[model samples]
Target: MSNRVDELEGQVAELRAAVNGLTEELVETKDRLRKLEAEAASEAEPPAERETKSDDHVVVVEQEQDDVDVATDSLGSDTASEAEPGEAAVEPEETTENDTNKSTDDIIVA
Candidate 1:
């Protein structure tokens, strides 16, 4: 019974070591694969085939405004929820974009 227990423990240790080595190899393989894929993608596309956009162009992604507020709240604000007795409440900036250039005729692909 004692010999059987010792043999089982040794097998377990060997199995664990093998798993660790395989995990490390798997991680290395994934890293290599990503690098190869990125290189292949770059090589496949020619410079002239890519569409370039102007730096001044602003991409306005239309989505639910409520989700934006929730995301911002989750990230937290610079101001403390309740300031020290003597400290003043820090007001966040509220700059609104002028819709002078905004248009409904927007195309994602264009």
Candidate 2:
């Protein structure tokens, strides 16, 4: 009976050691998973889309009214005649430095 009790006690000790080892491994694994998830979330967003602030400074986007054309030409221009109500006007970008002689009627094939 004593020998049988000793054997049972040894088995219980082995089981307790195994459970402790498995618990430590589980905790370590959970920590590693949390770190990996944080890294993935940070990488998913670009620098422009992320909300960020530095030293009490925040970034702001400003739209200048001077860049947009709100009034139509009264001199019978094609842009003014062809524009529809409730539609935004589009201004052509200057592509060349020597555009002094270029007309609005010129077709840019590129």
Candidate 3:
């Protein structure tokens, strides 16, 4: 009976060691997986992604400003037309078309 108990105890100890080793291996695998995922995410974001994101923001800002200008122009026109006599009503035109021209004149000294 004592020998049987000793044998059972030995089996339990072996199982515990195996379980500990397996737990350690699982943890290491999970850490490696997390590192791989992070690397993949970083690699997936190319320079073009950043440029597209910046262009999107610029477009959104330009659209919002255009909307505001349209609103203000409409309001001004309404007020101007409602004004009493003797005022010369002038319609606003695109005066500075050159202002929108992007010239790559600045040389980068590197």
TM-score per model over all chains: 0.41, 0.42, 0.42
Deviation in Å, model 2, residue 60 alpha carbon: 33
What is the total number of backbone clashes in candidate 3? 0
TM-score, structure 3 vs. true: 0.42
Off by over 4 Å in 1: 46-110
Q: Candidate 3's C-alpha lDDT?
A: 0.77
Per-residue lDDT, model 3, residue 87, is: 79
Model 3 segments beyond 4 Å from truth? 46-110
Residue 51's lDDT in candidate 3: 25
2 versus 3: better lDDT goes to: 3
lDDT of 3 by residue, 1-110 (tens): 99999999999999999999999999999999999999998888433212224564463223355567888999999998799888776997865656445343354667
How many Å off is the CA of 41 in candidate 1?
0.5
**Candidate 3 lDDT score at position 2:** 100
Which residue pairs overlap in candidate 2's backbone? none
